[model samples]
Target: MSEDAIQAAARALSAGRLVILPTETVYGLAADAGNPEAVAAIFEAKGRPRFNPLIAHVATAAAAERLAVFDDAARALAQAFWPGPLTIVAPARADGGVCDLARAGLDSVAVRVPGHPVARAVLAAFAGPVVAPSANRSGRPSPTTFADALEETGPSAAAALDGGPCDVGVESTVVSVLDGRIALLRPGAVTRDQIEALVGPLPADQDGAGEGHRSPGRLTLHYAPEAPVRINAQGASDGEILLGFGPGVGDPRWTLSATGDLREAATNLFRLLREADREHPVGIAVSPVPMLELGEAINDRLRRAAGFVG
Candidate 1:
């Protein structure tokens, strides 16, 4: 942490003020999790719905234990993904001591230990839980940089942690362990296959599709760009195209990139989206990416960007 960042975070948490902090996924609008007023300020700042809830960020597993009661499964997942992009929903341990508003009236609360040094620094300095989520308006793209946070949450949001660019550039994978079996509430940096390998086969949702109270990212029409987007097949002709995992044989207006490499595509996805959004074409078209390790998350974002379809 920079000296300025530590000072700013300390001051803000001390004063019960909200601060925008960086994480492995994206910057988050952070406030004292123990302070209801400060946590309320975060909702006001981000225009986030009280129904959506916020994730409490702690510096260490010991720190997280204070916020929620973890079972053995929860503990294992925490051990595997702490200091990384994964949030587990477990029963809150406060017994009404901590603010229930941060948990959205739910018995369980979402919590994680972010992989960013600045985030850890702030948590370490405050020596308390910080409730935060992506530092953007409720349904907008999550900001991966301090500049983007400033744009979304305004300049006076205290300090913006300069932790360079985010590695994942998306929200954390969320799993709910309050129930008997491990259930994936959201797909993110941690894939479903990875989870299955660790545990047994994931409990199948009998509803056949994940939605409503079941899964988080199952919401249609999410992670959308400001403009319309389209998806095209490989080597297929599309108007004003942006190839996701291959070369473009058409006009220069169509941006071209590789389809096989998920990491390269993930790194460039948002930047390309921003560029295409600025170009303001009738519609932005993306070619299909190959299905692989990180490809699931990449394709999920792409599907959302392209209005949840091909």
Candidate 2:
């Protein structure tokens, strides 16, 4: 919340430079959305596929409205989840003020109003849209800390806004509305059930894997870690160590929240991943947990970190 830091970040964005900014979910590499050249810098910096697109970060609902055409459904979702981890993809009006390239050449632009004070401050000062995605090299783990981003993105970033750790520690839930239907492209803090409760039953596959279905976050091989890690329940071999969610039965490499609570597990997942990387084990295994509940997101991250198919 430093005014100096906010001013420095605003200047970077206006000058067509990349700035690492924090959000509720993860740190993002931000560039001016109205400038195609600035937006292109993000793609080049991350090596991100142009087809994948980027999210436009805004300071308020008014700012977001200037970027895309929002229907009633899109407005409902925004009102309920704005300033949090949610991105709604709707058709970009021909007169939409954002750059078309920022939407990956699609008719819609992904937009969100971040909850972090520093991020909000930057957006307000810039007084325009900021196109951003996870602040890491393409296909690497999303950075939760400024130090980690510096390691990957390097000093090319004009400034890095240190917002401490991301609370959600993942990407936003992306809901796309096209052709008069609601689709969920990716799932995160917002669940399908929650969306359904408000909007009726949503399409099972929002990314369109099959007929009338669209897939979100279904991309194979994502959310990876720098080190070898695993999920195990009992003790481990000489090289392999235990990441215990319960009492450590014997010699161990690391034990996390031995009480085994899912909420605790989610909060500790990245920290443990970092610790495991530092230990540099050949592999780190997690104890198996039920997949129907909190275990779902936990396993999602672990599988992503381990580079295993989820």
Position 67, candidate 2: lDDT: 78
Model 1 lDDT tens row, 1-310: 6677687777887698878888888788888887888888887886666776778889998878888888888888888888898888777885624577787777777888988888898888888888877777766667776677788885647766777777787778777776566777666777777877776676554121332242234435555567776665544334354545655433444443443556666656665666666666656667766656667676777776666532
- lDDT of candidate 1 at residue 176, scale 0 to 100: 77
lDDT by residue (tens digit), candidate 2, 1-310: 7899899999989999999998877788899988988888888898877767778889998778887788888888888888888888777777766787777677677888989888999999999889778888776667777677777675658888888887777677778876678876776666667777777887655443331112223345565565566654555656765667755543344555567666566656655666666777766666775464456556666666666645
Q: Report model 2's TM-score to 2 decimal places.
A: 0.86
Best by lDDT: 2
Error of 1 at 72 (Å): 1.2
Model 2, stretches more than 4 Å misplaced? 206-218, 228-238, 241-257, 292-295, 306-309
